[model samples]
Every structure is written in C-alpha cells, then in structure tokens.
Target: MRSSPELATSASLRYVDVWKYYSGKPVLKGVSTEFSPGRVAVLLGPNGSGKSTLMKMSIALVRPDRGYVSIGDRRVDEDPIWARKVVGYVPEDPVLYESLEIVEYLSFVSSIYGIDVPQSRVDAVIRALRLEEHLGKFIGELSHGTKKKVAIASVMLRDPPVLVLDEVFSGLDVESARVVKLWIREKASRGGVVVVSTHILPLAEAVADRVVIIHEGSIKADAPPTKLRELGEELEEVYLKLTGYSAEIEELVRALRG
Candidate 1:
C-alpha cells in the first residue's frame, strides 16, 4: 500500500447535499463529500456518474441547483473568484490557445494567477513535465499526450491550495505519468488538496488517502481503500456490487478473456 507523503488536515473541501442538473435532467442528486488539504482524494465511477460535475462545482465553474459546495470555510457560489484562485482545475479534454506557442501559452496562464517570475516558473514546469521537446511547437501541432502534459503543467504552475483533476493521466505516457504522480504526491505533502477522478483503479489505489465511489449521482462508498475492501473483496467487485452490475459484467468479461 502506498502512502500519501502528507496527511491532510480535516478542514479541506466539502460538499453538502449538493445537487445539479443539465437541461432539466438531474445529474448529481443530493451528493455530499469532503476532501482534506495535504492529501490525495479520488472519485471513482463509470461514465456519466457526475464525477466531472462534482469537480466543476468545487471550482465554481458550474453552480449547484440545490445544495452548497465549500472549499475550507467559504462557499463556492458566494465567492467564485476567491474559490477559483484557491483551486487549480484540469479538465479531461483541455483547450489551449492555438495562436500561442507552448511556452507562451503557459506564460498566459501564469499571468492570470498574477504570477511573476514567469520565465523561471515556466522553465521549471517544462523541465518537470519533460515538455522541453515540445515547447517551441504551436499548441495545435502537439500530440494528444503532449497537449495533456502542457495543460497539467499549467495547472501545477499555479500552485493553488486545491487541485481538481478530471482524468488527468488518461493521455499521458508512462514516464510522464510517473512524473505527474510524483508531483501530485509532493504537492499534497506540502499542504495542497488534490482531488482526482479516473477510471484507473490502480492509480487511485496507489495514491489516494481516501476513495469515493459515486454512482447514480450519489455516494455508494467512501472510505480508505483497505477499509473499503473487506478481506474477500476487491475495489472493483465492491463497485460492481454497489452499482448492481457485478455478476453480469463478470460473466461477460470472463467469456471475453476465455
């Protein structure tokens, strides 16, 4: 079992009976969760499970319809700018400035954060993310993995107290992914809150101080991984069971493998 380099203090990000909708269709139905600073928290779910929506609410990108989402003591909706400043968000599919070169793109983001020392900071992030080879390239010309690296590097450069990552490692190559994982650990260790959503159970199992299983826009399980899985259970099995797809999917998977 891997351990978080820093233990989170209890007062981090918390959601209370949060509800949201799209086109009059319910997305998150009374979902509530808490995340702590100085630790890594992960949300796990299948497609359309509202994991991304939850991250959006935390960063004040989208407003909740019924409940409240808070970062530390302040409510997101009530203080959007402050909330955004304190949090760093990376979406699953990132959009970059096509007209700008990679280094220039990063410089622009730093400017939004009111970050001076732009050159040194950009250089440090580029080196850390191994983006030196692609720095000269225009944003549109970069590969998907390289683009993902740039987006992630931009968020990390902000060095906010809260980090919200939606499927952050999906497009990263193995080496880059390792570097990101290490960076996440270091950031959380130094008193930042990192909330990551991924389909990769191993990644979550490896780094998360706590795991949250969201299904049908509600939490089905929330606990430490070891505590979540009893001696005879795996995390996937528990997830399958909670979602009522365990037996059916298992049979199909076995048939395919066999």
Candidate 2:
C-alpha cells in the first residue's frame, strides 16, 4: 500500500455559524463545528437536511450565503484555491470527462493539482480499486460503480490533508465498499482529517470518531459513537429520535399492518 508523506502541520476544518439558503429556504442554519486531524467525522442526516451542502461547502464547491468556513488558516470564501488544495473531495455525484480514458482523466487531475507523482503510486491505487483492466476504457463506457472508483482514485492520488467523501459507498460493490472503509481508517491513523457524509449507519459505526447529526437545517446532536452505545442505543435509533422520525415510522408501520 502506498503511504502519504509525513504531514507535520496539522489542519482542521471549521464552520463558524454558517448558513445557506435556496430560494429563501434555509438548508444550513447557523451550523458550527470543527473536524480535527487524525479523526474521521461522519455527517448524518435525512434527505435534504444539508449533508451534501455542508460537504460541498467544505471544498468550496458551494459557497455559504452567510457565515464563514475555513480549512486550517485559509478561508473558503476568500481563498478558494488554497482551501481546495488541502481538500480531496469525492462529490455525491461526480462529473467526469466522457471522452477521456481512466488513465487520461487521472493524469488531468494530477496536472490540476500541480504534482508530479510517480506512476507506481497511481498504479497501486488503481489496482487496489480493481480498475486495472478498465484503465484504458473511456469514462463514458464504464459503469457507474467503475466511474465512482475512478473518481476516488483521482482524489486519493493527491493525498490531501483533508478528505471529504459524500456517499462514497453508494454505488460500490461489497468488496469495494470494504476497501474504502479500510482506506478511511488508514487515512485517519496517519493524521489526515476525513469527513464522510453518508446515510450508511454501518459505515458510520465502523469509521466515525465523531458523529454529527443534522435535522431540518441545524445540528441536533454531536457526539462520539461510543456515547450512543453507552446509552444502549444504536445509530439508527439515535438518528430517528434526534430527527423526530420515530412517530412517523411507527405510523407508517401501523398503516402497513392494517
């Protein structure tokens, strides 16, 4: 396995009273949190609860309407390029150049980062993700899962200080998902900050050092996974309670039984 260079400088992702709106509807309301290096923070929320928006803002893909977001000393709004340089983002829906082959696309990404990495490093990641056979195929000709793998490999090649993954395991196969989970753990062990926005409770349980739950555009709970387990609760139970979905689920189950 390829390893990242020793990152002596520590970095943290911070959201200071951040807020965002779409067509006058608030999506993130006065949200503030910090993600520290050597930890994996998982953001969990129901659909439209701003999980994706938060992840996007961390990498400056979506600017906040109010408040500030910073990665280390660089403000996202003021210095997007510098902020992005420290982040390796896997968007919820990644866009790729259809005409470019997998290798060509990865090379382009490397160029954008202004880094000249050894081909051996690239080969290691491709092989880990089981993409060796498809490296020569055009991205448009690959399956969704294959495309997602390519996107992951591209970002992993950069080995940024901060890694943001939005629903990364959504379309991956069983083995692929397992590989990614292991990768996240390894990254955190090496003092890299990793933020994963996902609804996969099991994945969160496996990797999260801290879990932040968002409900209706605001933070509802922020605690370590052990806290939930200490309360004799599972992640799903805590999610439903904090989000006020227990009653709704009970009602649905009752109606179905009738």
Candidate 3:
C-alpha cells in the first residue's frame, strides 16, 4: 500500500531486472536499482553506458524490453501517464518554441502539467533561475545558457515528486550552474527525489549525495562520494579506475604528445 503522497513524499523508485534494446542492440540488461526522496543521485557513465536509457525507463518515456520499473508498489508501465504526473524531466538539450516569449512558453508548460498554483509559483521560478530579464524576450533570442535555465524553471514550476535531469548544467556559466545547484539542493531538502546524469565528475561530486557509475550496461560502483574517498585518492580517480577509462586517458595523452 502506498503511503499518502503528503506523508510519503517519496515512493522508492526502483528498477528490477530491466532490459532495453535499440535497433536489435541491447542497451540496459538486467539492471536493478532504487532511488528515494531527500537525496540527490548522480548517474555516471561513458558515452554508451545506457545512462540516458535508464532515465528514459524511469520517466516512462521508454518501455523496458524485459523486467519492470516501479514506484513504491505501482508498476510504471501499468499507468504511464499517472507515473509521469509525479515525474519531471529536463533533457540534455531542451527544445522550446522559438516564437514564443519565455513567459508564454512557461505558461504553456505549466498548463500541460496541470499545475494550478498561483502566478507567484511561476514568478518564483523565474527569479530563482535569473530569468526575469529574458522572460519577455522570444525564446529564439535567448542564449543557450538562458534557454537551459528556462527549461529548468519549467521543470521546477510543477514541483513534481521526482526530477530527472540529463546534463542539466552542461551549458550554464559558473554562476548559473551554482544557482541551479542551490535550487536542486532546496528541493532535496524539501524531501524531493532528484537524479541527475552527467559526465562532469567534479560537479556531480559537489552536488550528489550518492554516485552510481554504469559501465557496459552494468553498475560498476554505487556509494556516497565520501565513502568512495576511502577507496581512492578522489572520487574522479576511482570513477576512472572503475570504468576502465584510465587506459583511455593515457592513450589520449600519448596521442596528443605524438
């Protein structure tokens, strides 16, 4: 039985024996993991470790070819729409209407999410993202970093129980990235579950409560960054060692020297 949404806040996001394939090629295979509220989870992997695929499964954007994904006691596939109602996703590069003003775009997104909050909610997000100056401008006129901020604000406006961000800090300048970090931290403090996937090890180390590394469709390591510090000189060093990227780093240096 599910605890009431107010009481539970988190529903224990879990994936069990999950598998996914693309064009006859397998991506995720027998993957199992769990995520809960009030914590930030970071997913790390090389270019093809199915990190994106796993997020897709959690958000009900893609179905697993085998196995299951569940929130607490409810199966995701059984009611994808309902499942999505509790999840908010911000993709690596969010596409917005170039013709619409930022405010208009936000209004449209909030309507789609069925958020009936007061305009103050939207105003808060705009201020938090530092989007006030650009809200009146057409999205086409905004810079890439500002566009990313707008996308993040759109996701926050819903105040969903779960947030999945894919490289969300990639294009932002240092200050904007810091703002995002604080915003996400506040959400986690409020008992929201946040999962972010990124290749930037330092940023993930800074903000994530737990780090999960995937290699070749399998979890290579999963632990708190502090816990990882005991096993390695630093989290990044252990990540590279575990993911077999240390060899690649040496080869790249050699090639560069050549």
Superposition TM-score, candidate 3 onto the true structure: 0.91
CA lDDT of each prediction against the hidden true structure: 0.83, 0.87, 0.84
- Give the top-scoring candidate (lDDT): 2
* Predicted candidate 2 versus true structure: per-residue lDDT over 1-258, tens digit per residue: 333333345768899999999999999999999999999999999999999999999868899999999877778889887777778889877899999999999989888878787998988988889998897789999998888899999888888878999999888888888889998999899889899988889989899999999998999988999886665468898889889998899999999999
Q: Least lDDT summed over 10 consecutive residues: which range in candidate 1?
A: 1-10
Candidates in order, TM-scores: namely 0.90, 0.94, 0.91
Cα-based lDDT at residue 28, candidate 2: 94
**TM-score for predicted model 2 compared with the true structure:** 0.94
Pairs in steric clash, model 1: none
Model 2, which residues run further than 4 Å from truth? 1-8
Model 3 segments more than 4 A misplaced? 1-7, 254-258
Model 3, 36-147: lDDT tens digits are 8899999999888999889888768889999999887889899787777777788887889899998899879777766665687778877777888886799999998888
Evaluation by lDDT, superior candidate among 2 and 3: 2
Looking at candidate 2, what is the lDDT of residue 239?
88
Model 1 regions lying over 4 Å from their true place:
1-11, 251-258
lDDT of 3 at 159: 73
